[model samples]
Target: MHRDTASQRLHGDLIGQPGSRDRLNTPALILDADAFARNVARMADFARRHGLILRPHAKSHKSADIARAQLASGAVGLCCAKLGEAEALAAEGIDGLHLTSPVVTPPGIARLAALARRIAALSIVADHPDVVDALAVAAQGGPPLTVFVDIDPGIHRTGVASPQEAVALARRIADHPSLRYGGVQFYCGAQQHIQDFAERRAAIVERTDYLSTCLAALTAADLAPAIVTGGGTGSHVIDAELGVLTELQVGSYIFMDREYSDCDLGDGGAKPFETALLVDAGVISANAPGLVTIDAGLKAFATDTGPPAILAGAGESARYRFMGDEHGAVIGPDLPGIGARITLGTPHCDPTVNLYDAYHVIRGDVLTAIWPVTARGRSA
Candidate 1:
């Protein structure tokens, strides 16, 4: 399982201890087991009721345990962003992995071919013809690998630029004997974090309309994609209502982060997701009058989203600042004293999660389990 030493030691010694939560070493990743369960169930039920296949992205949690939980709750499979993440999970016996990003390099393609042999339903994306041609050669090296033509919805990041280009690629994929043209992948990553619900929905509709054109073109050419995938947590509802994606690539709803929490979820004020994932940082120094230093800093949390949010103790005006790689200061009135444990909300769940080696799973005050982040550094 590639479990970290601290997590392994703690799991054996501190599990079932009355104050296990308090005894956790500083700057530890925490997951409220009950809340996490509820989050998983809610997303699964939503997908079931809506008639959408749920293939939640494993890139967010990166834990085989979490991925299994999602599968138990009716998720069809797990979607990964990197080949390394898929290989790591496959080693743990996880199946139905679909790589969202393209593997264009010679070595990456060879690895992709190898992974396809290891995993029965391994699928990948192709944004360019050279990538497709290379994948065709690799597919012959292993079993027939499922390839999804990545359709770019004006992001200019990846995928075929136009509907004509998409259709051409789909045709090219069909010509290859060891390749299966599964479908198209249109992920609007840029629109997922739009603060306002209406604005986010508008952005999704625009992209969804663009995807429809690609789908229509492919269908007209008798190359209709059997599985249309790609819709993130932020745009899940909007994308579902649009009736395009057959399956969802929703991630981050399991561990509601500050970025997704700030977005208007159409409930007026309440978020659709609960804050299940958290960082438990201990107060190190309280000598500063209005601010107290915490054990978690840049190294503990992701710096891309500014700073972590104090879930309690610090008032509404509380502002977290990065002091150093190993330390952070929470500036606000009536801060917690030294040794007091502070729960923090991550700004960006995916990257913030990558910083930790294990998750200290808590069911109330007891340490239930210590799930290792098996794919922590498997960013290949």
Candidate 2:
């Protein structure tokens, strides 16, 4: 009964309403269509200018609509952090998905094998010999599986630690009739969020040296990887400058969160991207002096980076705070009126997007599209 309140069925219902956002239920995820398209075009253009492959990470938006737009913009494919995420996108007619993480669980490998049999093309990474062996067995009955050596850039998250190990893994993968040695995936996640572009570049340069050592070893052994993939929104500008990765698995740039908004991408403190994603919440109670309660709280946003930063419909002094699972508080000299809408920039975009079921795409004041978060809750 309250699904309408959540805007679950408002695709064409908000076409011509004046001040349309004011009528939305609190805690709605909205995308500024114009800003979003600009971000997409800018990234695509950058990739083209540099002659690099672009496989934008689908784990960021999780919406097939966004994925389709990216493919049309000339992205080679999309990268999924999880196999289930790839499946969700594939069910919506998406192909050319590369799984970036290694799958080790017995049940997971079985599912990966089954998924490989049906999809047009699927690739995965392996950090250990056991994982490569399992994949080789799983691919025997399906189409040949492309396997990449997940190279560790001094971070043990998932990748082969040494160049020798990478070469060994590549040889093993190549020897298998059902396994094709694809390339390497080296990603230093912490480096991407360093805030200061110069510091981030210094860190990435160090990691690139380590990756270079691995690549040299692979090349000397005649096991050189053809497609090297890794990088994220925070480090895209730097990654392009370095020229190591043949392909970029950038995630996050499409929706500038509070974190990315603060990132100095060497553009003189201005990010190359704009904040296109926002959460619309409404004031529920203004009884407290200088403070008001809002409908969006912990459940409405991702808390890993901190509280959302107030965007629109709020005064200069506005500061947001999480009050509970279903409530938040805004304190400022000037607060929004009761039942008035407020926009927010999430601290982290990827996880915050996972919390929503759909994106309410808007152009000016009109709702243009209601795109489902195709891979939401598909993190397995």
Candidate 3:
């Protein structure tokens, strides 16, 4: 048997500690074990109290080891963005797979159908009848394939445009011999990190109304969407209040990014979660005045959301700005000298993590252990 005991051994020692290597490398992904667990526990406890199922988005970390940690902390399942990611997770032997994106081709559908047999639960989203038909044909009964009707909740993205369209698609799924109607998947990706709480709330409110209308329409047509899954880390609370979502598929709660940390979380002005993920880089050049350079840049971190931030009290008075691949410039007061180490909060957690092979878990400065980013580059 392939032993998973290795993960437990490695994860056991990689928490927060100081006094190890101050400047060993550059452009490395770092995980603060204590902060990560705290983030997990916080979300788990919230889900428990709210009576909402927590199916964390695995796309954020894309690590089977982290996915296992999330499941252990009370996640009902995992949400991956593509089939490759699902297959990777399967290789690690973690069950409960839900592909957030639709699988619509010959090879992809067939592969997903085969995967359903191995996982405890497998779900896919459909925006049209053609997609549903494709899945039904491939999944000719190894295990029942659950299909969620993707509804456009005002974002005009991957979901079906109208409630009537969603209902019609739902009927098709129910009639399909190989598919089980898994309800609705409504996620407004554009609103996930809107900085302004009111704007975010308004967007969700509008989207929720449309989602509820679609659910009601489905019910009127004698179609019951058993699961109404949606929401990200930014809108979990809003999803909870909507009373329509049976589960919250929020990711990034486990590792709050710089972009999310800046968003206003409705009540007063607090972030939905704490920042837990960071990139550790070293100063490669401190030869200029009021200017310094580090090893992390466009290739090391994601710039889609924004620039990364220096971790608090890391002897970093300088601010990090992306220069190009493999390099970043720093501008601030009393920046660390050459060979000094720095920790950075990624602008976007999901994509930033995709760039790394493994996370170097450390407690202050001690190199505790490492976990592979098993699902990285699984963008299919």
For model 1, where is the 10-residue window of minimal lDDT? 1-10
Predicted model with the maximum lDDT: 1
Model 1 Cα shift for residue 288 (angstroms):
2.2
| Candidate 2: tens digits of C-alpha lDDT, residues 37-150 | 999999999999988899999989988889999999999889999988998888888889999988899899998988888788899999888889989998897799999999
The C-alpha TM-scores of every prediction are 0.97, 0.96, 0.92
lDDT: the better of candidates 2 and 3: 2
How many backbone clashes are present in model 3?
4
Per-residue lDDT of candidate 3, residues 142-247 (tens digit): 7778999988877676889998999899999999888899888888888888877778888889878878889889999999777888898888777777677888
RMSD of each: 1.4, 2.3, 3.1
Local lDDT at 286 for model 2: 93
Off by over 4 Å in 3: 1-18, 21-24, 269-272, 312-317
Cα lDDT, model 2, residue 261: 83
Query: CA shift at 122, candidate 2, in angstroms?
Result: 0.8
